[model samples]
Target: MDAPFSMYGPDFPFAYDHWLKHPEGLGRIPVNRHGAKVAIIGAGIAGLVCGYELMRMGLRPVFYESGQLGGRLRSASFEGAEHMIAELGGMRFPTSSRSFYHYLDLMNLKTAPFPNPLTPAAGSTVIELEGERFYAKTLSDLPPIFQEVAQAYDSALEEGAHFSSLQAAIQRRDPNAIKAIWNPLVKAWDERTFYDFITTSKAFRHLSFRHREIFGQVGFGTGGWDSDFSNTMLEILRVNVTACDTDQHLVIGGVEQLPKRLWSHEPEDLSYWPNGTSLQKLNQGAPRPGAAKLFRDPEGLYVTDRRGHTDRFDAIVCTCQSWLLTTAIDTQESLFSQPLWMALDRTRYMQSAKTFVMVDRPFWKDRHPETGEDLMSMTLTDRLTRGTYLFDHGPDQPGVMCLSYSWMSDALKVLPLDAEKRTELALSALSKIYPDVDIKSHIRSNPITVSWENDPNFLGAFKGALPGHYRYNHRMYGHFMQQTLSPDHKGVFLAGDDISWTPAWAEGAVQTALNAVWGVMNHFGGQSSLANPGPGDVYPVWGPIDLDELS
Candidate 1:
């Protein structure tokens, strides 16, 4: 029998070329061969990867950052305790992410197995429905009782496949099998809930509850919190680093070390300026401490520290978040008119909060019943204002238990609490999950909350596509370094997670940077000429164009 809950039916077409041939297929812009100078914005993983790629492709890049690098991969110290490294924004990766693995291997980093304790108790899953608790020893024990429900789900999936095939068949004017399958699948795909869809469809009624459980379990593993795919990717990134040709090396110290090391380069050709300084008063403005700006021209790119001083560079590469670019430039109205800008604006970012609590010892080890297994109990709360996940990150120090609580958008709305309130609420929620555990005496809660909505420089947590948004504007990937205005404007190119195939993740950011590097190579390799180049490209260098365009 076929594996349960497989969305891919035998009839489902697995053609990748369909995306390439679609009307919106990579909308690649012609390159400007004479363009040489380039600027990279953002210093996250995406920016770093792009810079590395550009440098390898025979281009000198001066990277800029409005804040510390590794944008969200930040760590913090509590009460003089050892600095605790936690991903403040993006966390984890999947093994199935091929590109990410390739980049990691290229970087030559090492990996460690993620800390998931092997125990028999880990296999159980709990589900809550209609104020009642349900437990399953294995996926086969799930409680979906209606026979027709399974058939409906299967039929819906089959119909979805039929629709795709039908559309293809219609082009040939073949109407024989169209009406029987196409309409039903379309209606099913529009379903609001899995339960509703499964119960209403045919060919799915005979599915056993065990089959549903297996499907649900696998789906959870693939897409849920402990997703194996994402976890594998993270392992690759954690261990891989690119070999340095010079004395310089790129290894994992702490994520913050990346920006600090880059800043230490102190490139002579580049000048730095403070955020509020004017170009005219480059030498006269008082330096602003801890804040710096970088400007590039023919003489070189300059990075000015808070106190307005300048360092110059022959070229610049920006690997920062795109949202920072939205704020740093003076001509917001004009820049916002670009198709890329509109695409960026339309991207939705989910609001999330993570709370790390350090408690005295593992209380659950002793409080459980004789039959209870050593497992992290995950509770799904009915309360609208509660946190979603509560899991252990293991004990780092004696009597210290690390617990993480994550709140998604819905939780953010109902609780409506600030950082401090959120911490209290999270603690309260944790109490509910472990009722007998003594939370008050040992709880050392240091909550970190990021409101992507409030950050002017980071507008939101990377980028997420809204409904129908991904289908139309998918081709924006190949236009990163396309010439705009004139030939001189060619030096400035966009680089960020928003430009990749998948937005809002580290993988997307890295891929976009790679695409940007290719764009730069194509533009400067002499395929197209523009009337004006940006300020950074006043002095032009000519190069031959042979790189493949990604359209």
Candidate 2:
């Protein structure tokens, strides 16, 4: 499959590097603003990218982290394992996440195809439900009922949503064709839930309820999207149309390497900083203490660290999860208007949990005595274990297995359990699938587990938009372009996956970070070169059509 050029859709599909190539994004900063201070809150991909790009443009950006770096891009390793790691947060990168690949390519990270179910990389997949187990090497191998469910889904996407035509329009960069197809979809599906679309679409509604249940259990890309059924249909379309949930690659070693390397990397021909200067060298090898409070002072924006150290900056870009504005930090009442505050506070996040264990070797590779197949395949079950995945480092190296990867209701069940108990529960569930196999005997190290909902730093895994949430998203994404804000709100900008058209993807984080970077540049009197226009310079022409006007 060809890599997608856009993040949102046909209208806003320019690759981040391609957009930057437009003399507008070669990231030129005004000569006078070379040493201006800009405070970036959060060291996640969004914050780190914003700071890195700003530094390249010759501004001094100070970063603050309330927790560890890499935010949701975190990875966990076993005590003695050298190469094996369990991705605790964001793991897979789709070929269509063009903006994200700009950094991934620059870092030259090695990637392996993620083991999405039924895909070639997964090798084989097991779908078990209600005590009935079905094994398939490919979609063709699945039972007729299962194949019908898959076909119905494709038909619905094509008929109800114009999936293929929109994809072609995006490929061809035909603006009129894109607007004709995608704008209608935005109007039709933006207000509906995934379930609504599933139950009402002509092709899907013709199928039996059993087909819908099976489709929910083993979704087209990744695993079950039943957790997302209650989310907005627009959210589902964004994932599918952009190919974010398919053709994914896992970062070798760890995904955190992208942000970590960005921290230490130096760019050539910097406008202001020395040629060898990097973000690490600028912060003296450690970030300033975590921000405990943010408020406006008479002269400029002020940030108070956890230790009570206060510093003033010309502008502040907040890339942390939006809920932190109300829960974690001491934010002043006047910082954001009530409407914007509502959008930030109302950003709904999904609960997620992952438990991983290191095994002596890739034990699953052992062939079953009767079937001549690997004892265990990447398994998806309606049982307590929603999804089980295996990660092989090498024949000689320790291998990692994500025992029980679940979301929403399933994630809540293991939220109170410790790492050992989580691992034990997962193993117990797997025992039902492989009743004859000794799964626990292969354990080599202490198991690692994480519940994103249980962590204070990140209240939940990632934002999953609910129905009627398009207005909220529009308000948040447009914060950078708001010109009528009061003095206190003028300099503080919002940028994160939640503040983008599509949340929960690294591409969303990268695109929004660039938006905030441009906002800061313009805030300080910087301009994109006439030959190359920035996102802000070109947004009105290529952005999403307002759904209200279309309706």
TM for every model, in the order presented, reads 0.60, 0.97
Q: Residue-wise lDDT of candidate 2 within 1-551, one digit each (tens)? A: 75445554543644465765454455577798888989999999999999998998899989898888888888877786656788999998897787788798888888889988888888888888888887777989988998898888888888888899887777766767887887777777777999998899888887889889988887878989899999999889888877888889999989989999999999885788988999989888978878889999789899999989999999999998899889989999798988889889989999999988889888888889998887888999998789999887778877888998999999999999899888888988899998878879998888888998888888999999988888788778878874567776898998989888878899899999998988898888787777777777777787667665655
Residue-by-residue lDDT tens digits, candidate 1, 1-551: 42111111111111112211233322222232222334455556666665544433334444445665556656544444454344456444433233444455543443332222111223333444334544444434545552233344335544434434644443332333443443333232321334333334455445665445433322232112211121112111111111000011112323444433332232222222223322112213211222256444455445554456455543444454444444554322332236556665555554555555544444444425654643333333333322233233345542222233333444356335666666566556556555555566765645555555556556556554433343213434444545554443344455566655345444455555655655565555522223322212321221111122311
Candidate 1 has a TM-score of 0.60
Clashes of each: 74, 5
The models' CA-based lDDT, in order, is: 0.40, 0.85
